[model samples]
Target: MAYVAAAAVLLGLLVVTNLILTVGVVRRLREHTAELAALRGGGSGGLDVDVAMPAGTPVGGFDATSVADLPVSLATLGERPLVGFFSPNCQPCKEKLPSFVEYAATRPQGRDAVLAVTIGTREETAALAELLGPVATVVVESDQGPVQRAFGVSGFPAFVLVEEGVVSASGFDLAPVVDRDAVALPAAG
Candidate 1:
């Protein structure tokens, strides 16, 4: 009977130890998840704080010149310019570019209104420029340059709607830009 009692106590201790270890692991997993979200620019949920500047914020200091030498500026644009930031190394950016190019091609205003800034070498950005150049102006820069900063780009594949020298909407995805001025953006700040 004493042996039986000892065995039961040992089993209980083992169970308790397992429970404690499980809890610790779960807590560590939660911390890691939060850290990843921070690294992914606030996760896939929405635009991160670093890039969620509200609409109507004045945007300036971006050079209007492009490789094409076509003058482009938020203040000087005649229509609502959809600006996209992309990087050659970003998978999502590469995947998202086709849709963005299509959207720019089909914009209702029917002018070359879209603008894309890609960070890469001349060769790396050439294909991207070719895709967007027909319907948009393409600007190549080293690193995230002043134009991207003016537009609040915290990560690759960021986009914003600039109307009259100010940001009207921004998002990690294109849904917000699609719904822009028509509905609420999930990541709008």
Candidate 2:
């Protein structure tokens, strides 16, 4: 009888320990999720504390030649253009490339309405440029290139939806840009 009681006590302790560890893990995961969301520009933080340029910021003037040898500039961007900044060495940029391309493909104006700026050497950026070519106007530039500088982009995989040279939506994730046109109005009461 004593042995049975001791065994029961040990099992209870083990179960309690497991529950505590699980709670700790869940708490830690929540914290990490919040941090990642902030980094991804999903929070209320502005560009000063956020990952990239914020919505409503005006795009500064910039001029650069596309991979096709065509001139690309703020003035050349059609109304409601989508702009994406990527870096060849950034893992997140690579991971986000496919999604960006998919979203760009859905644009009504097609390739002419999207600009993809890749920051790296021509050799390093080749693959990215090719991937983005079919969907956007691919521009290869250095880290301090005019395109990135004009956008005030301090992070890779940054996306912005420009409406007449002004940012209507911008974020580290494409959600803001992709969902901008999805706003719905309420029905009359």
Candidate 3:
């Protein structure tokens, strides 16, 4: 009878703990939703996760005045520069960085294969720039700045392939492209 009472007490404690945890999770979810709404600019409470720029868009003409002393010129976007737009506060962007770094590792690193464009202060983005510095040309711009807005980027973690100053292809997520490209290459025998 004592064992049974002890078991009942333990079960009650678990239930109370679970209730507290659930309430905390619910509160976090509400806060997250509110943040999304604010970021969405009061757009019916939905988050846009898609790249706003369409394929074949001319990027050479896009003014990058907000980003001073650009490393790569808008006049020459290089043979094929994969431009990745990211934000400091984005969780997905943080998660996507490893995949992007891996993808860049497969190519010739630094000032060639890719451009890491971040929307934040230099201090805020310094770590990210260094993280990608070995594998890409890092460019910093203000949030919703000219270069970003000109590229039609509404969110972080987007990619656009630029060849001869025009966007060849673009996507919101890099995983599919990274996976596909990794598989597409012929195996060295």
The top-ranked prediction according to lDDT is 2
Model 3 per-residue lDDT tens digits across residues 103-127: 7767542356677788899999887
lDDT of each: 0.73, 0.82, 0.69
Estimate, for each residue in 100-139, the C-alpha lDDT of model 2 and write its tens digit: 9998887777899899999988899999999999999999
How good is model 3 by TM-score? 0.62
lDDT of 1: 0.73
Query: How do the predictions measure up, each by TM-score?
Result: 0.70, 0.73, 0.62
- TM-score: which candidate is best? 2
Local distance difference test, candidate 2: 0.82
Itemize residue pairs with steric clashes in candidate 1. none
Residue 46 lDDT in candidate 1? 39
- Candidate 1 deviant stretches above 4 angstroms: 1-52, 181-189
Write model 1 residue lDDT over 23-122, tens digit each, in one string.
Answer: 9999999987876665454245432454534677877656657778877667545547778888888877777788888777777654456778888777
TM match of model 2 to true structure? 0.73
RMSD of each: 6.4, 7.6, 9.7
TM-score of 1: 0.70
